[model samples]
Target: MQPASIDKQINNYLPQVTVNQKKAVLTVVKTFAEQDENEYSEEFKKELDSRYDEYINGGKLVSEQQAKKRIKKIINGKSK
Candidate 1:
């Protein structure tokens, strides 16, 4: 298998989450990390930044319940 595919398989075998969950996490993190602030329109940036408040407070990420809720909301197509 290709390196990328192999890495995906490994991620799928992660202890807790299923393959789809791992893939979704990878896709979101990769996409979000690659985004440029300028790519967002003013309104979208404002809203998203607000929603991310719990994910990042005091410039530190707290990836616990707050983060999980945000992820679920996004996955379910719910807007803030």
Candidate 2:
């Protein structure tokens, strides 16, 4: 589906959500809007999955909250 369609669906659901839910939904919308198709190709996903597995195998396992923090850190650490 098109980005506009996705945005419309998400916006339709956002108003009835809690504040935290709104923030999360907006963040998802922003990320989807920002991504480039080529930048998120299948090869890229496979490599990222491999890296995540390596991190896990290296004893870098974290709780859900910790994982979220580290994921943002890792994403921000990359040079876009």
Candidate 3:
């Protein structure tokens, strides 16, 4: 009845399933997940659109090297 038990049961039967059966199961899971009723607010959508437009219109963007350096600093717990 628990999630872990269900996961273990599914894992046990996975090896016996064909590739097509696995694909079918994945499709069904995706369909079920896509049925979520959550909706973003209009203000949030507008903020996203504004940010996207700014990025498209040559807004200041970090270079790949800078991004990697920032990520490494965060991972190493070093403050700027």
Q: Write the per-residue lDDT of candidate 1 for residues 3-62, one digit (tens) a residue.
A: 999889876677678779878989987888778533878899898988789556655665
User: Per-residue lDDT tens digits of candidate 2, residues 1-80?
Assistant: 99999879977887789999878877886888778533778888999999889997894566999989999999999956
**Candidate 3 TM-score versus the reference:** 0.45
Error of 1 at 18 (Å): 0.2
On TM-score, the candidate that comes out on top is 3
Q: What does the lDDT read for residue 15 in candidate 2?
A: 78
- Evaluated at residue 74, the lDDT of candidate 3 is 93
Note the clash tally of each candidate: 0, 0, 0
Candidate 3 structure quality by residue, lDDT tens digits, 22-75: 999999988877765466778989999999999999999899999999999898
Give me the overall lDDT of model 3. Answer: 0.91
Candidate number with greatest lDDT: 3
Which 10 residues in a row give candidate 1 its minimum summed lDDT?
A: 54-63
How far residue 14's Cα lies from its native spot in candidate 2, in Å, is 0.8
Screening candidate 1 with a backbone cut-off below 3 angstroms (N, C-alpha, C), the clashing residue pairs are none
The window of 10 residues in a row where model 3 has the poorest summed lDDT is 32-41
Q: Candidate 2, residue 60: CA error in Å?
A: 42
